[model samples]
Target: MIDTLWLIGIGTGSPAHVTMEGMQAIREASVILVPHKGAGKDDLASLRHGIIAAAGSTARIVPFDYPIRDPALPYLERVERWHDEIAARWQTALADVGVSGPVALLVWGDPSLYDSTIRIARRLTPQPTLRVVPGITAVQALTAAHGIPLNDVNGPIQITTGRRLRDHGWPIGATRLVVMLDGEASFQHLDEPDLLIWWGAYLGMPEQVLDHGPLADVATRIVAARQAARAQHGWIMDTYLLGRPQDAH
Candidate 1:
């Protein structure tokens, strides 16, 4: 049984985003688990390796084939089974390497934000003693990349997934929103007239890209850029802020 599993957030594929605490965890780890997301997304695993190396960590690196969530099942059920399989994979990796405690799994972005690492860890048999080193979140990275404030004055800023935005439209009366995990440029589906968008892809990385303008003016451009970047990079991680402008709000 694993004694301790450190969930260290590396943040947005950048070595600079790793916190001091996260570096310490990497350095102290007996084994570091890295997940391979197959061919097109190999960079995701590479970033984790880079983080560990940048920290000068000499820990054993154990790479495992990440399980793909079954799309045939409903979303919730598919996610539950995927988590179970991942937890099982972690167990197998640990046993194969013959290490128990002081294992580290580098997480992208903050562990507490829209991440399932902790939830999956809970499913481990004889559950590990968990430690989390919080890293920067995409929300923070996106806002900083564009040099924009997350909210206007004391107004609320709601964070939701792209699917919700597509299925439910804008959150009622939400003047500011941060959209994450949107595979489809869901904003393109909205017919809102006065909305504005600040979008960023690969935030905080060398290949970072940003765009902002009146939604009507730049919607197509953003989609084109996103598609081209995905084609070039084989994958992309992006988030966008949608809101009404000063007078409109």
Candidate 2:
């Protein structure tokens, strides 16, 4: 039985994103839970395996098929139900392993971001001591890969999802928004012509694609490219930053 649940951020499918502290935690863990998202997303699991392999840890790996969320229901309700299923899955995975030592899970990107693994961990009947090892986030990965700053100096950045951006207008207060998990290029809906966008798909991977320009000019291309990439690969992970240049207005 694991006495400690260590949620280690492995970054966005890259071993290089693992910090030394994360590596140390993996080495100390007796068992690791790796979630497989079926055939299309096997690489996601493979990346987690690679991180453990690189860390030189002999901890036993327990692989589980992630339960897909029901999209028919309201979004928040669906996520809540999905989280319940995932927590059940986690309990089942840890059942036979014995919880005497540390248990680790490699979360994509940082756990504090959009990940629900931390929330799931809290649902355990006998909650274990939790430790978080921060890794590169999609925001950081995209900005660094493109050599762009996340926000203007002395300015705040709002991090939101594609769904929210599409349903709600641009968020109030912050001019810069980092959008993630957008299935469609929702920026095309923005009526403002002055808005500029820096978009990236499969960032940090060899298949990475980047586009930047006035939203009106590149919106069509971005949507087309996103569709093509999704069809080519079984799955896709993308993020974008929207902002107006400081000198523009």
Candidate 3:
């Protein structure tokens, strides 16, 4: 049985984003689990390794193949099945490591955000003592990259997935919106004439890109840039903020 499980958030795509507490957890853990997302995604695994290296940690590093979700199934059902498979993979990795001391998993961005590491950890048999060291989130990175605030003065901001934005237009009562996990620039589907956008991709990385302007004017540019970035890098992580002008607040 595991003794302690540390969920360390490494922030979004930057080794420098790792907090001191997160580094300490990495140094102290007997085993560190890194998930490999297969070909063309080696940068993700390398980033985790780089974090460990920068921390000067000698902890045993274990790499395991990540499970791919079936695309045929409905979204929710596929995600549920995928999480189950991932948990099982984690268990197997732990067994292979044969460690009884504290174990750590390097998570991308803050676990409390749109991440599932915490939920998957709960499914483990004889769950270990859990510890979460929060790190910077994509929302924070995106805003920081563009040098803007997340919300207008005293206005409520809605954080949502691209699917939601695509399925339903902006929700009522949300004057500002931050969209994440959107492969499709759902902002193109919005009909809000006054809306402006601040978008960023690969934040904190050397290949970072940022854009902002009237939605109608810059939406096409953002989509073209996103497509080009994805083609160039084979993968991309991006987030965007949408809202009316600051004077409207």
Candidate 4:
């Protein structure tokens, strides 16, 4: 049985985004699992390394190849199988490191947000005592970068994925919606010019980009920019806030 599991949020690729509490957790960990998505995306693993280096954590570092999900499978099934594989990979990594005490995974953004680390963590047999250390989320970083509030005063905000927005459209009664982990630029699907979007990529990182405007006018630019950035970086982490103007509230 695993003793302890720490899912430490590392924010969106920024070392400064690492919280003091998260640093402490890392320093206290006996083993750390770093997932490598291969070259070009080496920055992902590097970010975790940077965090450890910054914190001066002497924890044993373990690297494992991340499992790629079958694109042909149905979405839910694909995700389920992917998480299972990740859990299995974690188990293997733990065994290879020969650790019996505290272990940790450095999560991008906040663990409780759109991240699936928690879901995969639950699949571990016998389960480890979980300790979560929160860090800055992409939504918070995006909103702050754009100088906009996440929600209208007392207004409800919906947080959803890109697939949901593309398939189901805007949610009712949601004046603001935060979109994360969008594989598709779902904003391009919106036909409404009244809807305004504040989009950011690599939030809290040095190469961060921010754009905002009516959806129709800026959709093309956002899509082209997203595609170009994804091509250049091999991977991209982005989030956006959609808002409809309210009556002077």
Candidate 5:
């Protein structure tokens, strides 16, 4: 009965991203699950494999194909269906192996942030005991890569998607924002004056790319760089911090 599941954060791509605690979780598990999101994105899975290998984990590695969301469904519905499908796959994979001890999943970042792994884990037949080993988050990596503080003096930080920032406008009273899951490069449409932008793609990876300046000055450059990087790598995971010009030194 695989009732215990270790949700270990593997951090962004770098092998050094996984924490010592995360490494220990990998070593203690009887099996580890890795998800593959189809073709042209082999690097994502390979990165996870590399992290596991670097951790010196001897646990059985089980790879599963992630389900694509149905295009016809509404946005929320599509995500719900996709999550259910993922939960089923997790169950089948572990049961098929007859895993007896603690099972683990190498989450890309801290399981608590913008990740549905914990939600999916709860969908299991009889929910497994989840112990999360936190690792560095993309937000942390983005700020570090750019050598900037996440928030201004006595300012509140808002973390939202590029879509929300596009649809609803800048969050009211937010002095800074860390936008994620923004494939559409939504910042190009913002006409706010004195808005500074700091963007990075493939954070913590060898092929990392970064750009920062007044949004008006560097929007086009960031767009071009994002396109070129995605074309070369077949995938991109990026985040950006937006703040007023006064926020920067």
Candidate 6:
């Protein structure tokens, strides 16, 4: 039986991005669960390991293979099924460790963002007390890396996924938008001539890449850079902002 479950956000790829509270949670937990996303994505697992080591935590590190979502299914359905499987895996991992002490899982970014760990954790049987340690979000990391502000003065910003941006176009009422979980560079789908984009890949890491300009002028370069980065690293985590400058008004 689990006593407490800590969902600690470790921030984007950089170990230094981990917040003090997150590190303390890592050091205090009796067992820390880390997900292995297979060969091409081992860097993620390695990053988690490095964080644990850097914290000087002696907690037992449990590694479990992450479930792959079936692309054949629709997006929502596929993600729902994948989360069920992941919750089951978490339960099994906990059973294997056979620990009743506080358990922790390191999340890539703030759990409240697009991440689903909180949703999956809710599915666990005999629910344990949940504690969340907030960490740096990709939007923050991306903006900071580019040395820019997230939104124009006195304007609202919409945050959404690549799929939504592709399927629904930009939402109304918000001039500024930040897109995440976009593997297809959804910005290309928009024909907004005045749109400006600030894109970053591998933010906060050694191989970080950033580009900004009118969408029409730089979209091709962004796509090529994204493709080359994925080819070189086998995977990529990226986020971007697309909107017109305040002066355009």
Tens-digit lDDT string for candidate 3 (108-207): 9899999999999898888779999999999999888877778777667889999999998889877889999999899998997788898998888888
Model 1 lDDT per residue over 1-249, tens place = 688989998888679999898888899998999999888998788778888888899899988899999999998999999999999999887776878459889989999999999999999989889999999999999988888889998888899999899899988788888999999999999987799999999988889999999999999999999999999999989999998888223
True-structure RMSD, every candidate: 1.4, 1.7, 1.3, 1.5, 1.0, 1.4
Decide which is better by TM-score, 1 or 2: 1
lDDT of 2: 0.85
Query: Candidate 6 at 125: error in angstroms?
Result: 0.2
lDDT of 6 by residue, 25-71 (tens): 89899999999998799888988999999999999988899998999
Candidate 5 local lDDT, 29-102, one digit each (tens): 88989999888899999998888888788889999999989999999999999999999998877766978889
Q: How many clashes in each structure? A: 0, 4, 0, 0, 0, 0
TM-score of 6: 0.96
Model 2 segments more than 4 A misplaced:
247-249
Evaluate residue 33 in candidate 3 and report its C-alpha lDDT on the 0 to 100 scale: 88
TM-score for all predictions? 0.97, 0.95, 0.96, 0.95, 0.98, 0.96
CA lDDT for candidate 5: 0.89
Candidates in order have lDDT scores of 0.90, 0.85, 0.89, 0.86, 0.89, 0.89
Residue-pair clash count for candidate 1: 0
Stretches of candidate 3 exceeding 4 Å from the true structure:
247-249
Residue-wise lDDT of candidate 2 within 94-127, one digit each (tens)? 7887666788999889999988889998888787
* Deviation (Å) of 86 in candidate 6: 0.2
